[model samples]
Target: MTEKPAKLLPPNPTIGVFDSGFGGLTVLRDLLPLIPGARYIYLGDTARLPYGSKSRETIARYAVSSAKFLEEQGADLLCIACNTASALALEDIKQAMPIPVVGVIQPGAEAALATSEASPSTPKSVLVLATTATTQSHAYAQSLNALGLAATEKACPLLVPLVEEGWIDHHVTAEVLRIYLNEAFAEAPNAQTLLLGCTHYPLLQPLIERTLAELNHPMTIIDSAAATAADVAAYFPPNPNGAPATSRFYATDSIEKFQRLGSAFLNQPVSEVHLLDLGG
Candidate 1:
């Protein structure tokens, strides 16, 4: 495994990104444009996914292993793109790994704070849309509150399946999101920022904006994938003339499904996903 360099990053650092499944590709998608001349190693632990259902200890073990695997592949930085893993096992992974590990919660909260400050007229409140486990974890609330921004976490349990099923613009999906947003808005009318707590939500950003306009409530939308990418981007200076990024994707299981769905998540073709077996 590569050791953390004394400095933050090299000229063209290798970055590791991991999620339980295909959703993490969204983070990688955002990263390519932000940090040019970089290498990305993405892992979809498809064989043992839905880390939300596992115990905290188990989640930590799995996430740490994934981080180590990426490190072994020459990653200097790691992004735990999964909300459940970020909520449940971030510290464990950070402690075990030799590199910097940035999770979605802090970046989202900080971005909300920055955006809220930019708009003095709006309330310093954030509405987070995430999975039930993430909402119950209250990780976003704690992070936001620490920065003097109030947070309301709404668990959109149906959104993940809807997203995975490629229903980004379907009417039923829109209705479900509309209901969730309305319910969340009812809870926090003052929320000025909508934080996407789930990486899968970036694909639904267009539809989310439409729904907000339909409800006559237009809040600044924050994609954590973008936020996390920006956070990682801070490690290096802008280099417009840098070389194009190269990527390698590995899936623990279902390479075909990962390649199929990963294309949509990445908004680009995904080919030659290597199969990796991390023992259970």
Candidate 2:
């Protein structure tokens, strides 16, 4: 008797990724290759960016609006890839959206914990480098501490601007990172893992590693963008022979700037970016 062929699921699921600005493209970049069959929609609320300065209530409102927009666009799942929004507004977005929502903070902390557990004999501590808002929220610290790992969070407010300026390997950027890492290490001298809590930081991974070596603190660096992508991937089944992934970009502000700067973050050409207005 001939055996029945294996059942096949839909070739693609519409995934929506939202951020307060262009940084989150790093997460989408990782997701693209991993989940090759998915249709991705990326929204950068650039008009109201620097969400770091906004209050929790304001951030929540903006995040919810973005989430709803994605839902309207038929997103089957959503990824809140902004650290500030993830820290302050994840719950609101989750409740507002009908689709499943994932945030960056939790997966990052979990990845740190798993990395620590991998070496059972040594004491493990995590150092999180993030935006001021995320550090102030203490989301990463709380999550890691809950998993029984000591955690320290450092707010690198300058890194975002530097990355956005396309200065990933500039000497000035390196010096800035050195200063930040110096202070961070001073606070968490024993930290064996360094978690890049900002989505933009992935573009500076090599520079970070070099800085850590210079500081005499060679630690395992965890890219939260990659970690969050890995977590999101768990929700979808394998799509080995599925169609090539496609993406749509939307920005609440200048589409030209989004296309130009976003290309750096996504590590690929961003050809068409639609302008959106999420309102004040």
Candidate 3:
């Protein structure tokens, strides 16, 4: 009998994407097209959300718990989709976990750099709209420095709750965003590049774009989820033929709430969500 050629075995685990809350679903939505055949498990700590307001120590603790849960779920790769956790506890999580870790911060930064490089005027300044914690973390600023661009970050504190409540098109939503945008622009008037640093912000993209258009400013808006999704795509197996991709959603609190609010983020009906208690 002739010896058989060695067969290539597929990876036996799923990719875990963790975020403070449903905001990370936006990242998942963007990543779906990039990795069509990969399996994914997403966990949203809705009970302990607004990680932006918590201390770094608390955020790290939450991150640890989240990572542990994913590990138990047979995750071979991890993606920290929350900028707050990525900024505060990425190193600790990476060190504690056995699998390779990826984050949204660097990918967003790289996109900002590429956007700047492509523009003729060289982008005198760029605006980063993120959570209060992300702005304080200075993750975007450091990334922009590595690429030689002056970046300014604005903390849009009210936007998260607005997004979580599914108020993307509410009249008050526009007013709230306008106030933050005005404040951020005041701080960095020359900023010609704008970065939607938080995943939830993308849901408000149309409003944001309209606001920018009304201002009559020629600025480029960067969607961080899209950029991070591209990064996630680069890590898949080289072969095109593989198992079809599948996604699972988990929440620390109400699965009903997650399914309802998640429709806005995922742009589809979220029929299944498992409740997980992340006791810290």
Candidate 4:
């Protein structure tokens, strides 16, 4: 008699998203509606955050540790939502995790490229607004250039702090955005694409758009957080039934603060944030 074949089980569809702090919640926010069937595990390395200041080796070590913890939690896929980590530690995290990994930088760059290419009459230049570390790394520039598009990256260090302070619509924030856009436009006058390179910058999108309009420079703005979520969603099978997504939050420090800030970024109440210790 012929033996029956062993039954094959489908892989778990849990996704792990990592960032140095609450800024990554914006990425998670966009991901929820797009891939509602998958469960999400979000980890914010708040204890050793501001990964922008750390050396690349240190960032890699921290990111790898976080990735390993998520892997232990049975994550089938990983999304590096921190621009700094995506710039410096993406490869390390990918190697350390036993799952498919996606980073924000590539998706953002691809979006800019697509936008620029779609309007051939417009200049083939992209302007990237990011944190000091990401701009210094030239990750966006390199990624765009690889696609044959010219990129100019401006480091807006103050934007992160202002956004964190919940000053998204304040006049001060608008003025700051105006100044930054003026400087960026001066550097890349013909840029037709504006890529928000830092996760936190999405909170300031309206202000950035207004500032660009005031400057008389109309350009397509690419929110990397949203683009990253869209790209990640493409990797999963569609949820035709529109199921609700379940999410768990973890932080290396200050669960209360994580919930408070994360809720703001997510535009929804963030509850039951578990504390995690990744060590010094």
| The best candidate in terms of lDDT | 1
lDDT of 2 at 58: 97
Quality of model 4 by C-alpha lDDT: 0.87
Off by over 4 Å in 2: 1-11
Give one digit per residue, the lDDT tens place, for model 1 in 1-280. 1122245577588999999998889999999988779999999999998888889999899889899999999998898999999899998998999888888788888888889889988898899999998998999999889899889999999999999999999999999999999999899998879999999999999999999999999989999888888888777666788799999999999999999999999999998899999999
- Per-residue lDDT of 159 in model 2: 93
Clashes of 3: 0
lDDT of 1 at 251: 94
Global lDDT scores for all candidate models: 0.90, 0.88, 0.83, 0.87
- Misplaced by over 4 Å in model 3 are 1-13, 238-243
lDDT of 2 by residue, 221-249 (tens): 99999999988877777889878899999
Q: For residues 131-200, what per-residue lDDT tens digits would candidate 4 score against the true structure?
A: 9999999999999998899999999999998988889999999988888888988888988889999999
lDDT of 3 by residue, 1-280 (tens): 0112133224333789999988888989987766657788999998998787788999999998999889888887788999999899998898889876778888887787788778767655789999888989998898777777788899898888888877888889999888888888788988888888998999999989888887776578888888877776665544456566689999999789899988889998888999988885
**CA shift of 148, model 3, Å:** 1.4
Give one clash count per candidate, in the order shown: 0, 0, 0, 0
In candidate 1, which residue ranges exceed 4 Å CA deviation? 1-6
Clashing pairs in 1: none
Which residue pairs collide in model 3, if any? Answer: none
Worst 10 residues of 2 by lDDT: 1-10
